[model samples]
Target: MKPFSGTSLTDHALTTGEVLLTYWKVKAEYQWDAGLAMSTYLNGLKQGKLLGIHCPQCRRTLIPPRVFCELCFRPLDQWVELANIGKINTYSVSYVNWDATRRQTPEVPAVIEIDGASPGMGILHLMGEVGDTLEAITRRLKVGTPVQAVWKPDSEREGAITDIRYFRPIG
Candidate 1:
């Protein structure tokens, strides 16, 4: 609707429609590969299971599912079941959903260093029963405190990211 001026022809376009037409010329491309390993991991979540790969070389277990070890730069061939239990390393509460479509209805997000994982290792997830005081860093939630996963109903279960509904405090 307005004329924009700049060095490039696209930037110098006289109309919004023309500018959008020129923008596609420099669009970036990406390729995604969904293989069996990833599918298996998702399926496991739906079944209320937590999985990880163990690096025999370093004796460290990686969670949140990875096919390789970045520390040793080696392919992790051995797989293991990670305890669904973990600890709240760090956490936060979001007033809005990530897509930005939902209004501010408090959601608690946390980074749990799953049990059995090497020290300082953790997975990012949400915490259950957390409210607007998500910024309460001085409270409990110590790094080694126990936690567990909260799963979705079987009927609504999908072998994907929504599998484990969320994580919660464990006694």
Candidate 2:
């Protein structure tokens, strides 16, 4: 038995606040490349295809695609094609513009959980064609409302997030 010098424990307790502050500073810098999955999935987008990853263990398809099986903690090389349509899980009206530079006239942003995806997984994009009378819209926002990405014109295409202008109602 030696002296109980818990340096690791002391260090964690002493620097907890500093650790949290450092995380806050780095959060914006940590950009996840969900878009890169497009290499595998976006071919579908270009040809109007919807792609997802299937986990054999959970037997669930994960949209936006993943390289590893999250449920089984294994690697997934299998790809599955999904429907181009999905549902809006939730949405909000944004009054602020990007970079907070100005007040956005009025826009609806939504979290769409596509069909055939794993539980608790979704994508965020702009919601278009929202009517003036908000009450007329269904507030339920159930798990199966059909939606699709509205792409920008070739002249305006920038090969980035903005390429898909917005996720709008599939009417």
Candidate 3:
């Protein structure tokens, strides 16, 4: 006895018929391999030493070591130890989280070119101990600032990048 009091098919095609819906909640676990060069690199980190791969063909030493030379397409076989000290290549002072959340304490991330690696070869790391105030930090920490890795204690290291807590000013 009751009829639907709604728009017709021509007016609203979707409103007249049933629509099938599906929800996929996948919980897939993945295990990634760091491969040969990175494996050795992580091993070195556990010991508080910085390791890099040497590309003989192009004569470049790469930091955050790689399995092959990106420039020459040659295998990187030689592992060279790098100085924990490096210079700030470039940096930024962030006031918000990556998710756009405002952070109570700003973070200073810098790209540091580790010593013994080719120019412009660097790793992204956080900056610390550059003074408390923005004026002091900006004055002291800038491009070309000499900084050293503040490594966490060996017992606390988990073969992760955080093994180096942050890069602190050398002087």
The superposed Cα distance between candidate 1 and the true structure at residue 135, in angstroms, equals 7.5
- Candidate 2 per-residue C-alpha lDDT over 37-68 given as tens digits, one digit per residue, 9 for 90 to 100: 66767555555556788888888788778788
**For residues 30-81, what per-residue lDDT tens digits would candidate 1 score against the true structure?**
8776565676677777777777778888898877657778888887667677
- Per-candidate Cα RMSD to the true structure, in Å, reads 6.4, 9.2, 8.3
Would you list the clashing residue pairs of candidate 1?
none
Query: 2 or 3: which has the higher lDDT?
Result: 3
Give the whole-model CA lDDT for all candidates, comma-separated: 0.73, 0.67, 0.87
Clashes of each: 0, 1, 0
* TM-scores for every predicted model: 0.70, 0.62, 0.82
Error of 3 at 120 (Å): 1.0
**Superposed model 3: Cα runs more than 4 Å off:** 1-26
Return whichever of 1 and 3 wins on lDDT: 3
Tens digits of per-residue lDDT for model 3 on 18-96? 5444569899999999988888888898899999888899888899899889889877789899999999999878888
